[model samples]
Target: MTFLKKHKNDILLILAVLILAGGFWLYSSFAMDKGGEAVISVDGKELCRLPLGVDTTYTIGEGEHFNSLVISGGEAWMADASCPDHICVNSGKVSLEGQSIVCLPNKTIVSIVGGEDSGLDGVAG
Candidate 1:
């Protein structure tokens, strides 16, 4: 009982911080706008833009270098790739603006773009 009284202010501060953290987590998780398109790029060049509403598979590059992108159910993911690491294939789907999957070996990037304004000037790491 004496300890509680002595540390009352500290306990209150901790609770306040936890509550704020939880609120921010909820907002960041649920407030994102669904992306409109998935922009495919290779070697810093724009290749194509696929709509998120359409379910399709696109093959990027040719010959020995290739990456397969699949879009379905309003999300885009790397279906397959010729890259040995296959990190992009395991990166999972992206359905929010500014999210991306990069295949360093293939020099390919798949990024989500064209979502509603998120009311933020920019995001810093």
Candidate 2:
């Protein structure tokens, strides 16, 4: 068509952008460790590790400062907590290495890690 011929360069640019975006999305999704585990910790001490691929619920902390963690559908989140701010409960589910839900009040931290994460003793930045 004459219209396409006149705007062929613009069309090619848009197509290129779409292709690049699609590739990036695919790469990021695949890079995540889907079978990783969620490491729960309280007061700087490790508590437990639950696999993300399995559905389970766990309690952390003690007494009035309890936090309820739920892992389902390959994601982990804090479903309930007694912390005043409830920030941990508000944190959305995570399913990727290094992603975490933290409860400062309860000194609880739930992080998605390991299984297939890229090798690193640790890294900053």
Candidate 3:
């Protein structure tokens, strides 16, 4: 009885800490809505806005024999190319920040930047 009396507050405090941690984890994982537009750009300017159910095949260069590629479903990835190494083509769909699909032979980079209203400064403020 004496031990219980002495450590009652400590036990309650530990329980409270655990509950708070679990709540925070749940909120961060599901409560936040992170879905947004997929923007492709070069040098800080917009290039393409790909929406759902629509796709476009892009030629990578100016020459007559230049290779081509396609971006589909708000996911711009390397679809096809003429380069010796198909690394870029196999990079897969990128839907998050700092993700990119690049074709080295054509000097073309298909990267995923954040949505218009989603940025570090905007969120902080």
Which of the numbered candidates is closest to the native, going by highest TM-score?
A: 1
Which 10 successive residues of model 1 have the least lDDT summed? 116-125
Question: How are the candidates ranked when ordered by TM-score, highest leading?
Answer: 1, 2, 3
Best by lDDT: 1
For model 2, the run of ten residues with the poorest summed lDDT? 116-125
Measured against the true structure, the TM-scores of the candidates, in listed sequence, are 0.68, 0.65, 0.46
Per residue, candidate 3 scores C-alpha lDDT tens digits across 1-125 of: 99989999998999999999999877655654432344544445566655422467666555532445565654556666667787777887665554567756655566555565345335757
lDDT of 1 at 32: 65
Q: How good is model 1 by TM-score?
A: 0.68
Clashing pairs in model 3? none
User: After best superposition, candidate 2 residue 83: deviation in angstroms?
Assistant: 0.5
Better of 1 and 2 by TM-score: 1
- lDDT tens digits, residues 29-76, model 2? 888665378999998999988877668999886688899999887788
**lDDT score for residue 13 of model 1:** 100
- TM-score of model number 3: 0.46
Deviation of model 1 at 113, angstroms: 0.6
**Backbone clash tally (model 2):** 0
